[model samples]
Target chain A: MKKLLTLTAVGAMLAAPTFADTLRLGAATAQTGGLAPYDAPVMEGIHIAIDEINAAGGIGGTTKIELIEKDVRSDAAQTSIAVQELVDTGVSALILPCDADPSLAAIGIVSSAEIPAISTCASSPTLPMIGGDYMFANFPGDNVQATVSAAWAQEQGHDTAYIIYSPDSQYTTMPLYFAEVFEKMGGKVLGQDTHSIGQQDFSAIATRIAALPEQPDVIMTSSYEPDFPSMLKALRSAGVTSQMIGSDGIDSPTTFSLGDAGEGVVFTTAGYAEEGSPLEAFNKKYMDATGSESQTVFNAVGYDLIKVIEAAVLAADGSTDPKALRDAIANLENVQGATSAITYKGTDGMPVRQVSLIRVKDAGREFLGSPSPDAALIPAPRMQ
Target chain B: MDIFLQQTVNALALGGTYALLALGLAVVFSIMGLINFAHGELMTIAGYVLMYCGIAGLSFVIAVPLALLASVVAAVLMERIAFRPVRNGSGATMLVTSFAVAMILQVLFQNLISTRSQPVLLPAMLSDSVHIMGMVIGVNKLAAIIATVVMLVFLDWFMKHQKTGIAMRAAAEDFAVARLMGIRANTVIAGAFALSGLLAGVAAVLWVSQRASVDPLMGFMPVLKAFIAAILGGLGSLRGAVAGGFLLGFIEIYLSAFLPPEMQEFREPIGLGIVVLVLLFRPNGLIPSATLKAEKV
Candidate 1:
């Protein structure tokens, strides 16, 4: 009777669809709070891509991609809870928040369930290293981005640089990478200072920079909006006229919206919307879908994440099985995306994608060509 | 000498804002025995008003008054709608109620305005710096110091001379006796919230000047610091709140200026540790109130 019952259950399963008609992708990204500026755009890009893909032919030309999203509210504890809730719903893959600390919060659940997870735009290489094989960061590594900035600064003849870094999170520690590569390129680090996140007053930091006998040729930091604007205003107000170099954290309307205060600041990001490039096309779609022009590279980063998943599904020959998907994604090579051709194969889970150098010119982003730094100069990921 | 002068100005500017906020919290807590965590929301209310006024292209002259008024009105309504029903409950109940009010206000701000920080444009002169004796000082920082001093003076007169102010003070000293002495509990409590809201508004303007933007959670940090300042001084003692605010500001700025670069990240912990040491020495805070001392005895 038991054998017959098992055979009947197997027969019923075979009678159902041969493969899942829909693939559930769970996202626990910040819709509100501090991380919203980055995660919101990325989510919009993801939405646009999912809509375009499902409308065209769905992933692997059959299974529709279904997004099950929860706002983590930029809270780490909430990230874990949201991830667990999504996992309980049997999601095949997870899209975590855009910061390393919050994304790290969801790793245990996703890794234990063998479900693959990807951060929207966390540049920290530590995500993959710490989250193990099943976790991936869908953006360029911090070391890679920082190296690009340092190389660009060298090319611009910036011989001495001062750094203001926040030791608060892995995301804010990009200055260390920049400092390492800058020194490797024979540039002198004039000074390095620290600011806590949510620190509104930058007068002390600015005063220190201004008090230097000979001002450095450039200043670098990884501060984001709210803090970034105040920092720039304080530095400029304090008469520190050095060229400012920032990481992708400053890629927000708030930065450009500073008008004259933000003028001539350069930052490194995941992609440049080069004319006629895939990123440019995505920007067009984004404007139509959201009725606002894409302001940051994060929109492209979000578009790439969906493209990556679709490519993996097709590469796995239309299997939605978690392990099969993870293996296929780990082996994906040169999958052309909105940002650049992403290759996860043989690179652990951190993609060596193109890094766009952007200038805050005339209150808007000016795309400088994606320049690949000398690989040897790129610093190793800081484990801490 | 130049660096000393500059940081002193910075410390004063920061302390002034914290003092106003701490005084605001202390005002309500002294009268009601309820730590109004939602006092931050009053500041947030003022900030959002500034944002809206900026959007409407209103000049700062008009915007400032409108923003202050908005905060005062919001505070009155907040008490009427939320606190009145729970007024007769335990202190813990009112404390939880204030937290709920804060959370609800934050959610409303997120949904109604934006989850993102909205830029609040002030007069461009606010960003300008003045040079005096080889030292540069921000015009906004000076404004904050002046504003705080002016408010403090006015508050001093109001508390000492006004009839309603005396009533509120008497109520804070002993609510039951003040009620028997003909001070209406409702009127005095409402007056306290209004005064608290006004103080929060002034602090918010100083804060908003520095950031030039406002988000739903913008008030969280300032209020948290102010709460600490209030406790460090003595929760119900107005003078203690002011002293605590200045002390916190001085400690923070001096540490930032003097601490080695490698130890800069430890500034917060060290600041709190210093506060703990001070508290250990003076368990009743720097200036415990007579009523509080009597209750302790």
Candidate 2:
């Protein structure tokens, strides 16, 4: 009887499936180009997270994560080629570029290969909707970000709002969503205008705003960097003093470079750099590694992506199969991330994340608060 | 009436910058029959100089001249190093070579300086607005208009009075005849590039003043507009280039001011349509050069 029992246990052990020693993650990102400003920091954050995980004996205490990175050179065609090469190498998952249109190139390749991919910080909710189920965005969707900005604007006793947006990209059209949520929340939309992405002259737009019957109580735009600062200067120079509300696109050093012009202006970001918080710790780490303080909010975003993926790997019980990993990621909830608690549960592909409101003052960013925008008030993702 | 006047100031300010850039392109094209697309890089070079000047804590007065000089030097060097070798080549070769030079300079800017926009803090007074007859005008706008007018007047005198400038004009009218008349081709071409660079430098300062920042691609849009303006004005005619620049600016500003808010996004397309209509009727542009010639195929 003892000999028979020993033989039965050995047979069961032989039947069990064993996980691979290392899970391969393919990262096809822009290392040099326009997207490099955002992608480089995210890549650094990912490297930090990978180091942390590997030091802790990897995800699920055994299955190590191996990152296979390729530079897409910020080109859509290069993105497709890079993704195909990575997929051919049998990567379990993929990390894509920071913009929706560019990431779509990789998404098409990943989806057919049954691999899951996530954008580093693309806020466009329409990204996943167009890229199919295998694609996910690890950042807050544009709808959620706009909702937060509008809600905050309403709470500040502002009633009249004007919107200026660029029709250039999904990210720049954030003001469209802001206008939708602002009006829905009982705030009146005075008007909305469009500017091309690279437009340097905003004097015409400013003059039109100045000619309005009554200046708007607030002006909202989703423009970034050079454009945002230029617009602000033009508006201020034209004597349009209505408060300015901006989305995450304005979370840049150039915005604060406006000096007094940038004062009291509010914008949304992924997380606040609160003292003693995990975000603060991560910033310290980032500074130590890169010899500069975090300039944009994407570093934390990159960190959160890896943590979410680690959670998914844990949930999959150490299985590195693409389908198993995808299923686990879709169901992940309350995963502790560097910036906030991340949840991908009960949504198409956008994770429910917190939005941080920051105000520019004294030539620096002041953390206002991280507010959870009301879910019911969030507008549906607009198809691009 | 007040709104119209206000928009006019806005138009002149923008138009002046465009005219400066357009005139820069026209100068080189007239002399060499080559549209130096790398003219934009000259503007970018000036921007970087201003940025570095800011970093060095130089005042606007000192920085502005230094920036202009840097642009002049960069333009001369660019022609000497890149354009001179291709000067004797086909028109297509020169055009392609200019594009290659522009690309190389852009890449160097991205790699050596930064792909991100770098801030250049100008005097706060530049952004201040003054009320005049119920119309608010930016100090920078006033400065732009004044500077453009002064530069234009100076260029007119130089072209007519200065020996080197007259030689440049002679070369523009007919390079082979000017060469036969003992006007050095190399000196005249280099002089044209230097003048173009000076105009771009002036425009760059105003451009940076309005935005208070610089980037690798900062000159791309303005240069493109300048190219369109040059085409709208007779490509080889300096005066025509100026007229085209102002016209383009006025059309764009007026369109924005009068167009319904809902149709604001169509401003560029509509503006371009007007340019096309003008070109359809007057193919040589608003002020076609008297020297414009056709080669027998």
Candidate 3:
């Protein structure tokens, strides 16, 4: 009987899994280039999320999630290379931040590998339309944010508004969404202007806005931080002080540093860390680890992505098969996370969560409660 | 009318920054026969130095000069370590070396400083706006323009009359012949880099004062503009580079101001279009130097 027991124990030891049994996860993020600002916060989120999972005994009881990072260097070609390398390394799923164009460039490669891919931040509607079942975004697309922001402005009694946006794919589409919603809500867009990214001086645009016969009650802009401040400075210098509103891109520390010029500039964004939210705990963890505030939406997304992956892994019930893991992620319904309750309803539906609208006051951001659904349009009587 | 005048003043201020940047590029290109792509990185380095000094409790006045001095030292070192060895090498080799140095500097900056953009603080007076003729103007921009003009004038005098400057010019004109005249090739090249870095340092001050922020890649736009300006003004001519800088600045600003809002983003491209037109008409740039005649042929 002792000899039989010893043989059984040796057989059990031989069946035990090694590091090769762990599931590999790859992140192809903007490690360089223009999008680095957004990418950095997302990476931080990924690290925090992954750490939380590992601490909780990891996935499937036996297989831990192993993270491998590759800097796409913010190039489309590099993104493809990074994704292929990660897939080649046998990662079960690939994660990326919210850059629409570059993310699109990597889709063919990702799909060809038969590996599940999710963009934690890429909110462009084009992604889902293109990748079908293979692609998912953790956040709402630009249209949703734009719709919500315009609705909020109308609720605030902003009837006459000036719209300024870049013609670039990301920024241009956002303000167009706002304009469509605002006009439908009876708001008269007094003027529509366009500027290119990286064009510093906005004197001409400012002058045009100032010269309008009917001055806009609010000025809405869609651009990133670099040009946003300069635009605001030019407007302020010209004494054109229509209340300014920006898209999610305005949620940057650099926006506030525009000094008095950036005062009262409000914008919309996904919730970062609100009081009594799970993210508050995550924020504390981030601060402790990174020694800096997780200020952007990317931070929260980063934190939550790890949770989503871990949840999917646990729900798989000790299965390390890639196909099983992919199905597990797709079936994630109402998983409560620090950022939001993430649910995947396949490729055809929106994530069933509300978007947050934030405001800049005294050079700091404040979450102004979740916008009302009707906030996308002002009441019809006030539109005139 | 007031707005137009204000726009012109804005153009002039922008032109000043451009002139300084172009002058730096021209100095290095003329002496070394290679464009120092790292020239913009030199500006970024100096800006960071000023930022460090300011954080260390030095006044902007003291910090600015110290930063400029540091830039000179860095430029001299770069010449000695990176450029000097490759001096007699092919133009492509020197160009590639400069690009390598720029990449190294960019990575160093991103690792050491927070890659996230940070605001560059300036003294209160530099940020304040002044009104003239019913138009608003930034006092700092005005100061930048004046400083640029003064530096240009000083540089012109030095290049024309100073013995060292004359020898450097001689080297630029004919390096082989200048060596025969007992002009040390290393001295002229080192001086050129020093002067280039000095101008870059000053330009950084003006640039950071206006933008109020600094990042690792902040050098990119300015450097590209400087390269274009150097070419537009005549590559081998220092005065022409300064002229090209101001001219490019004015053209960019004016185009942005006068064009429709939809076309404002195209201002730089429009300015470049004009430069192309000038090149097509003149072939050797707007102010071709006599020394570059053989090269053009």
Candidate 4:
């Protein structure tokens, strides 16, 4: 009887860890706050990726992905605690949305744990430089978009550009970088105005922009979608006729609903649901599966992020070891994706990929084309 | 000079929105002595109602009234369900309950209406602008200012002339004494919440028109601003709340204009700094009421 009891205890101990082989994926995002617009789609994308990967035989052939989602509620401090909770649950990797400061705060925890964390939409230049090798961003940093936007404006013969940026971290840096490039390219910056993130009235700034010796040929604003419509509306109401240009943050259906006020407003972005290209195929799959259109680029990146992780796992010869998978992901090159040519260069080099410049034309964003490397005439010091 | 005038006009327009928000918040604070943390959420609920009505094919004219009535009903129900249960409880209990109510409403809105940003469509007239004194003013701004002035006048008249309103003021002054005077304490508290809802509804219309969008979290900033405005004006003084709202609005815009472009983002901080200065000079706020006494319980 004693020998039989010993054997049973041993068997139970052996079986427990096999059951624990399930791969845990953590998602820490702004589930309920101002950033919900960006975070919700990213969450949807993560779930879709998990479902697809699990269906196609998950990591190590047996390990299934289990998602543990936590709401950071748009507070940077709360994100640290959320990440810690995920770490406690033995999350192998984390998927985050486009939050710059919060991501920076959680980087140390993720790095120390040696877990690979990929942010679906955070494109701040500072991210790559500060996060070292452990962090990866699915999209090109804001500087790349800023460089392309300045070149596009100059290509359209806009010599005088009025730039407005939110003093909030992510949006501010993008326009500031673009201004640096636009100035380097011999285009005069008429006036550089800064606004607080949630300021409803843009009249003072609009009045100043309008009173310039010569009204700017183009006004470039780097701000999120919620504030962009009001800023544009105020600018137009104040009789400032300068053509408005915005960054990737403005690419949403909400922009079109701004009605004629958003007409002639040009912005640079990567994905649009209306385009029936191969890119739209992925979007269509997402829509068909979820019964909702993938309206933003973050959703595509979310899908691509899971695919990249899957590819990395396969490339590592079925190694579920975190370090080996991390190395494989860092060494990713020439990987074709629905949105762009993704190449995950290690901490030392930039990720060389093709980024598209899209414009909102006639109430929907249309793909302009791939940004020509040589066509980008401006040289701004890369901050990241 | 034109820019200066334009900025001042902008300040006045913003002030109108702040004043209405402060009025709504102050009404609840004065009568119930319960800081309705959910006050802004109530406004958001009104905005959502309007959005839903519009989606259901109701015209803006009909939608606005329906939204306002819904908001009033919501506020009254909240008083009955959430606030009334904790009426005689500790302040901490009341505060936590209000926060709980806010979270519940926020989650409900997220699941039901939308978790993403949605534009608040405006009528064409509200979107039009008229140039006055070299400053551009939208019809929306003019309407907001007119609405605020009329509401303030009507509120003053109600408090001074109406029996229920006088009883509410008496209750706010001393609840025990007012109870002895045959005032129904529950009715007075409910009326205060209803009034708050009415003001919130009007403010929601003005605020949504400015952003042209409404989200579940839209109430957050406005609520914080109104709280600060009420404290700046005097916690229990309705007139003081109005004064503080306009004061905060002017200071924020003035700082935005005078400060360097890079520093314009510090406008809120500057406004708060002024508040600190005011508190240091006048601890009871700009306009204090003699009847406003600290509660022992």
List the pairs of residues colliding in candidate 3: A45-A302, A98-A121, A98-A122, A151-A375, A151-A376, A152-A375
Q: Give the number of the best model, judged by DockQ.
A: 4
Candidate 3 per-residue lDDT over residues A1-384, each given as its tens digit: 756755643443345323234667889988666677778788888888777666666654456667889888778888888988776666777886567778878889877876777776776666656765666667766666777777788889989888888766564446667777888988988867777766555656665666567889888877775677777766776668788878766667677655666668887766756677877887888898889877666787777777777777677775544566667777888878776787775534235345777777787777777653553342211110
Docking class of 3: acceptable
Interface RMSD values, listed in order for every candidate: 1.8, 1.4, 2.5, 1.7
TM-score to native of every candidate shown: 0.94, 0.94, 0.90, 0.91
Give the Å shift of residue A347 in candidate 2.
1.4
Where model 1 places Cα greater than 4 Å from the true spot, the runs are: A1-19, B294-297
Q: Which ten contiguous residues of candidate 1 chain A have the minimum total lDDT?
A: A9-18
Interface RMSD computed for candidate 2 is what? 1.4
Please rank every candidate by lDDT, starting with the best. Answer: 2, 1, 4, 3
Q: Which ten residues in a row have the lowest lDDT in candidate 2 chain A?
A: A9-18
For every model shown, the clashing-pair count is 0, 0, 6, 0
What lDDT, from 0 to 1, does candidate 3 have? 0.75
Model 1 Cα lDDT, one tens digit per residue, A243-341: 999988877666766656778999988787778999889899999988987777788889999999999888877777778889989999999999899
Between candidates 3 and 4, the TM-score winner:
4
TM-score of chain A of each: 0.94, 0.94, 0.88, 0.88
Q: For candidate 1, give the docking quality class from DockQ.
A: medium
Going through the candidates in order, their DockQ values are: 0.55, 0.54, 0.42, 0.62
lDDT of 4 by residue, A34-98 (tens): 67777787777777777876886675566567788999887788888898777765665777656
**lDDT (Cα, tens digit) per residue for candidate 1, span B1-297:** 888888888889888888999999999989888889999889899999998898899999999999899999998998899998999999999999999999899888887876767778777787778887787877877898999999899889989999889998899899999999988998998899999989999998988877778888887888899999998998899989999998888888888888998788899999999999998888778887667772333
Of candidates 3 and 1, the better by lDDT? 1
